[model samples]
Target: MRLRVDLLPHGQYPDVVLVIDVLRATTTAVTYLERGADALLLTATPEVALALRGGEDGSPYLLGGERGGLPIPGFDFGNSPVEATGQNFTGRTVVMNTTNGTGAAHTAAQTGKHIFLAALTNAHAAARRARATATEEIAIVCAGTDGQVGLEDVYAAGVLAEYLLAMGEFTVDDGARIALTVRRNSGNPLEALSSSGHGQHLGRLGLGEDVRFAAGLSTSTLVPALTLDGDPPEGTLRFTAG
Candidate 1:
């Protein structure tokens, strides 16, 4: 078994991929399942998310996502972890589209069979499950901000790398190493998160609690694993508890 970490660059596929967007998308998704969500379905665009489950027909689909750090016009929920609280997702599906996270997830689904959502909140569970399944290679993908590297995602990736290293022996790339270093240097993950560009953005939007929420490490025993349960072009990346 080989363990590797890297960003989800376009067209790069591995045996299995773990997607991270800790400053709230991936963290929020995991939180939903931790609460009671049956599954989450991610899409690259809002139109696709809306198309997957149309309204008024007794479907358990609820639209949720964000753009430019703001909730979509008609979304059932925004990209906030706090916003997901106290909602009833039992036997329902959350069809989501985000500025960066869902796009990375969609791209990862193009080639990988086992896709796992990773974040500081569910670090140990995610790494354990990912390391157990992947045989050839594992890519810890960070959903960067608009094609550029975001510090928060990289920091969360670093946490995943550390957990993966403790689980088994493997080779880590420079990207992984850099993230690991960040994790090592971080005295308090929340402090690191509070200073990141996205973290500050969320703070400005009155979502500072969310930034703290995303940085909560290993607080959850649940792992959100993405399974392909439908056909492509309009396929669903369904989340199941692992």
Candidate 2:
């Protein structure tokens, strides 16, 4: 198998793609599933998420997302793993639209045969899922902060790659190598995150606890995989535990 990591969202990915947004998005996604959320509908914008929740489709969905790393004005919950930890979402779907992660997931769904959300919280499980499902290649796509590559996401990708490399033989690209190097040079997960640009920004906003929560490695076994309900663009990327 071949492994490649995209420091930022790019062109077509391999057969299996893992999306990472360690500062928050992907971590919150895994937490939602771990807390019994039936499904997560990822939207490109907050407007779309709100529309879906208020639509007459009869599907009950809770609006959850963040803008500028803060909870949206009308959202039921922010893109926070810590907040999601105490909530029970059984039999309900969450419509999420984040500043970075949702857009990256949408891009990957356009070409990737299989897409899974990854973060420091569930690195091992995400890597195991990719190894078991990917036939030849796997791509780890990082949802950088506001279009530029975020150190936090790259570090999480390295963690995922490390687990994948341990499980089997794979040729890695330079992007993956860079991620590995970052992981090697970095301190613990929380330290790595707290030192990053985005992480520091969140800290300034009083969201440092979320970063600490996201730093936990191999803390969860749930792997959230994306499955489209319809075609691309118009279709919805529904993620569920796999």
Candidate 3:
């Protein structure tokens, strides 16, 4: 029950990789999936995502991503969870690229082990699942903004660490402790996020409301786990049965 938390660089390790992107890739993915999007395809590069959309055999995928906190030109949607929450993506696959979230996914995948997509939305369920896996260690990957620690992402990771702690069996690491401490220290979590690097960037683009939405804790119970092909799995919660 050893646990370690690391920023994107820890991606090379052989541990359960939990990718967190609070503002707001992972958050948006979980919202879309829970609200009925069929699947989400995480891509490292915008070119790869765009190429997949144009490929003849590709599924009808909507291109979603952001660069510098604004929607990439030619993308169908911005990387805002609020924007994604409204659609009934029942059978459509969302192809996404992001400043941090998606890149962490690819990096973590390099470990060649199981990976899970996490955010405050699915914190509890995800931690429970990780504990059940019987792995000696788990690495919670925080997708900070531009390789620098971002409050929202670290806060989300802390939420997961707290959840795992509540389970009462796993050993926590210093990184995990830092996550929990930071999350608790943000006396006014949403307010604290309004000043983060990503938050400020989104603010400049008139996306302040989205920052508030993404900062919420436990808004949904769905856990959007990554599958072998980088697409979200069929079920909303990976550990749940049909």
Candidate 4:
């Protein structure tokens, strides 16, 4: 097996891809699935998500996501894992659009045979799923903050890599090595997240609890995998518990 990490969402990926956005997006996704959300529809922009007001049959869809780490004005929920934990979505579908994470998922879907959303909340499960599904290669793609690399996402990638390396005989690239190094040097998930640029930014916005919630390592065993509702661009990317 071969393993590599993409610090940003660009370039071709391998057979199995794990997308990480530890600051909030991917973390919120895991929380939503764990909390009983039926399905999550990911859109690259708020406009697209908003356009999806309901299913084909007209059942209402809940809107969720953020821009600049703050709640989008018209969104029903911000990209907050903590807030998601307080709601029950047993029979509802959610449309999500964020600053980074959803776009990363769309990019990976273009190449990856299998794509899974990864975060500290489901690091172990995501790694295990990749190990079980990957036949030859695995790419860990980080959804950086505003197009720049996010340290929190890298740290989460390292956490996933640590688990993957232990489960197989995989050769890793420099990116994977860098993630591993970051994981080794970081104190803990919360500490790493709390000190990150995005984390601090969230703190100033009074969302510190979200940072703490996202720092929960292996708290959830659920792994959300991407599935297409139609085709690319016009099609929707939906995440469900895999």
- Segments of candidate 3 deviating more than 4 angstroms: 55-59, 229-242
Q: What does candidate 3's lDDT look like per residue over 78-127, in tens digits?
A: 88888887777777777788888887777777773667778776777777
lDDT of 4 by residue, 127-160 (tens): 9999999998999999999889989999999999
TM-score of each: 0.93, 0.95, 0.88, 0.95
- The lDDT for every candidate, in the order shown, is 0.82, 0.90, 0.75, 0.89
Model 3 weakest lDDT span, ten residues long: 233-242
Ranked by lDDT from best down, the candidates are 2, 4, 1, 3
Worst 10 residues of 4 by lDDT: 227-236
Cα error, residue 124 of model 1, in Å, equals: 0.5
Segments in model 4 whose C-alpha atoms lie over 4 Å from true places? 54-58, 229-233
lDDT of 1 at 221: 82
Worst 10 residues of 2 by lDDT: 227-236
- TM-score pick, better of 1 and 2: 2
> Could you tell me the TM-score of candidate 2?
0.95
